[model samples]
Target: MSAILPPSQRLWWKEPVERIEIVWIAIAFVWCLILTFMMPYWHVFGKQNLSNEAYRTTPQAFAAKAQAVVDKWKVREVNGVPVVKPPAGADIYLVGRLWQWWPAYELKKGESYRLHLSSMDWQHGFSLQPVNINTQVLPGYEMVITVTPNKAGEYTIVCNEYCGIGHHSMLGKIYVVD
Candidate 1:
């Protein structure tokens, strides 16, 4: 190796050989990221047709199952209290108003609640973080998402989709297990 050069004369990072190595490394890193997303266990993204692959069940086999959930999800309430029976599972709901949540909704330990989410006005994003998750709550249309509270702690439900000036502070709390 040659003696260390002054800052102005240094060429270690710009060598042609090192440049090629960096390119190859970048390519390999991107390829690994693509593969990691396709794996079944990681459902954060690129998890296509989850039920079919995870349960080994075809579309036809799931007909009854889908109908069952739809029937139960048809009825819903505004806040923690249920207007109708909440299908015996974990449920999430989002508000269309900016910087506001219903303010209170608590989950019980081990017990599950069915999450029925929708927007009262415009399209809103319902995110249950610490879980790396989000779901769209569209106006006049309902989307039902199910969650099981595995860990007991405080979690934030923030709006991931842009709404207004208060978008950053649009947060709510979920206490799992009490």
Candidate 2:
């Protein structure tokens, strides 16, 4: 009765499949089609989807822009890193370099900011902890995402990509205050 028998001894093709088997196969095919259509549908209508807003820019230009923002609204320096507190609704920049994320950010709770991210030398992974926002940072491209901090606390920015020997030390911070 098994189909795996030798071809000379078995005529499995002549055997009729059961009605339940045919019904199951049809159900599976329809389910697959439904699942295939759901992917693009959710991507177009989902509320918590990733932004497709990005642009091309050089590393030097991006660094300059980030430095300017730092110099303009830097409240203080912590361990030689500037902690910038740009006003809500302003543009905020974060740069990923060889082994660090430059300059920390301070934002107000419930206010939105346009966060621009880029890398200097290599591809980096930007993973904001606690809130769990993850994105890829490229060297020659600038990626922008609008973020609103809904809670007041200290959040850590961890580089999840392995760049070099010091990758484990590549960390940044963001402080959200009321």
Candidate 3:
């Protein structure tokens, strides 16, 4: 007889479910309930949730804002990229374009600043290492996050999305001073 065929014995449907099967079913239902509640519970009390502070904006306008910060606070240039040192509590902007994170930032330890991020040409991922802050950088929209660095060191901002052939070269930096 084929495995797909029903059992030749009669009255198979009349048998009661085994005790072990009932216990397994109960366990699975309880697990499903726990999994369903965990997401909302974590969002209410999680320390590392993604910020929901984003807005629709044109790429031109966003670029203007980023350029204003670069022009005002640019202290130096490294590898042809501007390194801006905006004051604590001020706004800072980072732009992702073609293959780079433009105009790196210099921040002071324990001071908070509003950080704005946007993409100029394509979608990108903003991943700040050592601090573990990751956000999506989408074209024509701005993502804002408040950051307060607690340690004094150099941090790296790497693109976690594949943009193009030069995706691997798209790296940025942030310097935190005590």
Candidate 4:
């Protein structure tokens, strides 16, 4: 490679970097250090963390629990689907199976609810559209999602994960009432 360059230009690589280049290099190093310290600092001090609360239960056991929630809340059949309007600050249960999300709920606006979501057959997605809250529903694991609807409207719940040929038909609803 030295044979391709003239003798006068061969000493360029031996020279030190300029002062501005050194300053930029130092700046980049400090920036990297700052970024490296951010994650642990956030974990210790920030109010942001992933929810790791989950429990193991069979599909049958979960179904019984869901039925208890439904029976206790006075579930009504709306066009062959169950719809429950539980009292304020009540815990709600939702069942997800192949191509279906059962027992739509009616929630009071500005009231908090603990939604216990589980799957009966396969992995599914709990996606509330228009509001855009999404979470995964896995079989044998109950995932709890806490939400308080601030706006009064009907939010469509659709499965965002592909489960089967009728995956597109997996839909539900949550009515946020005034």
Pick the lDDT winner. 2
Worst window of 10 by summed lDDT in candidate 1 = 48-57
lDDT by residue (26-84, candidate 4, tens digit) is 99999999999998898789754435678898899889988888787755776677888
Clashes of each: 9, 0, 0, 0
Output the number of the TM-score-best candidate: 2
Comparing 1 with 4 on lDDT, the higher-scoring candidate is 4
lDDT for each candidate structure: 0.56, 0.90, 0.89, 0.85
Which of candidates 3 and 4 is the stronger one according to TM-score? 3
Candidate 2 lDDT over 25-81, as tens digits, reads 999999999999987888888645567899999999999999999989999877788
TM-score of each candidate structure, all chains considered together: 0.49, 0.82, 0.81, 0.76
Ranking by lDDT: 2, 3, 4, 1
Better of 3 and 4 by lDDT: 3
What is candidate 2's CA lDDT for residue 5? 57
Return the clash pairs for model 3, or none: none
Question: Candidate 1 residues 43-154, lDDT tens each?
Answer: 6553322222112333233334433443454344344422222334534443334665443355665666655554545556878878867766565554554456677877
Q: Give stretches of model 1 more than 4 Å off.
A: 1-96
